[model samples]
Target: MRAIQITEFGGPEVLQVSDVPEPVAGDGQVLIKVDRAGINYADTHQVENSYLSKTELPLIPGGEVVGHTEDGRRVVALVGSGGYAEQAVAHAPYAWDVPEGVTDGQALALVLQGTTAWHLLKTSTHLQPGESVLVHAGAGGVGSLAVQLAKLWGAGRVIATASTEEKRKQVLDLGADAAIDGTPEGLKDRILEANGGKPVDIVLEMVGGRTFDESFAALGRFGRLVTFGAASRQSAAPIDSSRLMKGSKTIAGFWLADCFANPQLLGGPLTELFDLTAGGKLRPIVGGEYALSDVASAHEDLRARRTVGKLLLDPTR
Candidate 1:
């Protein structure tokens, strides 16, 4: 089988496509014949040694794969490694049936982002109907899904922040009540005005750095701020206790990989996410597809911010 192996961490150039032994399913695991494997910032971070765990070199960096088992059942699997190959191994318990009407690429796109969005909504924050919410990176993988979920879950005003006019329009088309430019300091004010002077009850923050403090300032009394990623590549900021004390704000962080390690807590959100997609309440946006051989280019595009929405790597290619 062919796979993209990251032998050393540096740049996308380090990702090389080479032949590797086909993976075999262990007793409690299943082998997924790879179709499309999702590419995320986590994969990029892992390759650069920025992931929470120190990664072992020569690693296959993909996480979620949409494909079939030996028996020909359509499924989405969350695997440890080898997703950037022709065949990958996944724990049986982590393999989920793909929805009947969903395409393989769509199914693959949803696994990581969908689960994260669901957990962010149902676990990280409590949004009441008629309350406003703000989501950063609103056109990116998790942001797009987060906007849809917030709307479906009955958020009265859903504000999405995007870098470009095109991305801002994309989120509006996906059901965001209002789309604002993420750059300007006026974003918080725009959100505030859109909600009729009510501060946002929940903030789904993926962009850290300057945006983090701005998000904190935009929260209403007793509001929740959920940080899922630091797309801005900024250092962690020290929390201002005075701001929390003044506004009754709460800060929470979520990492899906860590959450998955605790199944007892992850099970509910995982199952609910799948159910939402299967029922047509949530949709996955697979914006780009690339051959596995193009792994380096894919990572380059991701790092350069040249791509939008979810990216998938076709391992069979």
Candidate 2:
């Protein structure tokens, strides 16, 4: 089996395709013939050993894969690793049947990034109807979905932040009420202006550092800011308890891996996301697709903010 492997932690340059032995399925696990594997921004961090979770050496990069099982059942599975390969092992419980009318890339999108967007709104923020929501990196995979989901859930306003004008337009197409510049400079003011000179009721913040700071400052009373990723690779300032008390604000952290402990958390929302996609209510944007051997280029494009929506790798290529 050919797979992308990393023996050292650094950047996309560390990813190298090698003809490695195929992974074997363990107890309660099944072997998957990899068709498509989802590439996330977190995968970029994983390669550099800077993600929320630790990255072990001699590791394969991807965590979510859409493929067929030994029994010929098409499924999308959230594996620990080894998804950047011709074949991989999938834990049975973590795998779900890819419903009819859903493509492989769409199924892969719903597994990690899609579920993250869902949980960030439904579970972490406990978003309320008619609440104004701000989504950072609005053209990216999770942000694109979050914008649509916020609208579908009856949000009063959906303001998005994107790096480029084209990306902003894409965000708007995804149903954001407004799309603003993502740069930290004057970001708070832009967010407020977009929301009718008022602070947002909910924020889906992932970019850390100044982006996080600006988003936090734009939150209204009783606002919730959910931090799921730090794409900027910079830490935000320490939160002040007194300040939080003053505004009744909340700073919540969410990692999709945590949902693995409770199956319902991942499974339930995934079912909903799948149904929405099948019914044509939810659209998953596939920004780019690369061959398995081009995994390094995929990571590079993601880290450089040169891509949008979901990215995938075709193992058969």
Candidate 3:
């Protein structure tokens, strides 16, 4: 079998396409003949050894797979590794059936980013309907889904921030009430102005550094902010406890790995996402596709921010 192996972590150049024996399913695991895999920002961090968790050497770096099993179940599953290969393995509980109409790429998107977005809203924040909401990186994988799902779940006003006009427009088309520039300068002002000159009730923040500070500052009294990523690869300074205490503001952090540890909590949202995709209500924006041999190029594009939405690799191509 062919897999993208990272013998040592550094850059995209280290991701080598090489032959390795296919992984077998363990006693409680399921073997999947991987058709496509999703390339994620976390994959980049794993390669650099800067991820929140450590990754072993000689790793096959992919997080999710959309493929088949011996019984012919077309499923989307979360794999810890070996997704960037001809075959991968997943635990049975984490492997979910892709609905009849949801395409493979869409299903693959749901396994990681989609589920993260879902849990951010449903489990972590418990967002209330009719509250104003702002989502950073609204054009990317999780942000795209967050924007749409926020509106679907009944946000009174949905605001999205993007680095490019095209991306801002992309989120608007997906149901954002307004879109704003996500630049570090005057970002809070822009978000405040976009929300009709007031602070927002909810914020979906993933970018760290100045962006995190601005998003936290843009929250209204009793506002909730969920931090999911640091795509900038930088951390924000510690929040002033006094300020949060004074304003009744709350900040929460979520890691997808935690969700993986508790699969019992995912049954509802995963089923709904598949149903929504099958019904054409929720959509995963797939932006780029690469052959398995070109995994390094995919990583290069991702690290360089040269692509948008969900990117995929066709292991069988």
Each candidate structure's TM-score, on Cα atoms with residue i matched to residue i, is 0.94, 0.98, 0.97
List model 3 lDDT by residue over 1-317, tens digit each: 98898889898889888899979889889999988899998889999999999988979899889999979999888888889998999889988888889998888777788888998988778888999989998988899999999999999999999888888889999999999999889999999999999999999888899999999999999999999989887789888799899789999999988867678666567788889989999988998999988888988988776677899998876
lDDT of 2 by residue, 118-144 (tens): 999998999899999999999999999
Candidate 3 Cα misplacement greater than 4 A, ranges: none
Best model per lDDT: 2
RMSD after CA superposition, every candidate: 1.8, 0.8, 1.1
Provide the lDDT at 21 for model 1.
Answer: 84
Model 1, residue 15: what's the lDDT?
91
RMSD of 2: 0.8
The CA lDDT of each predicted structure is 0.83, 0.91, 0.88
Best by TM-score: 2
Query: For each candidate, how many residue pairs have backbone atoms clashing (under 3 Å)?
Result: 0, 0, 0
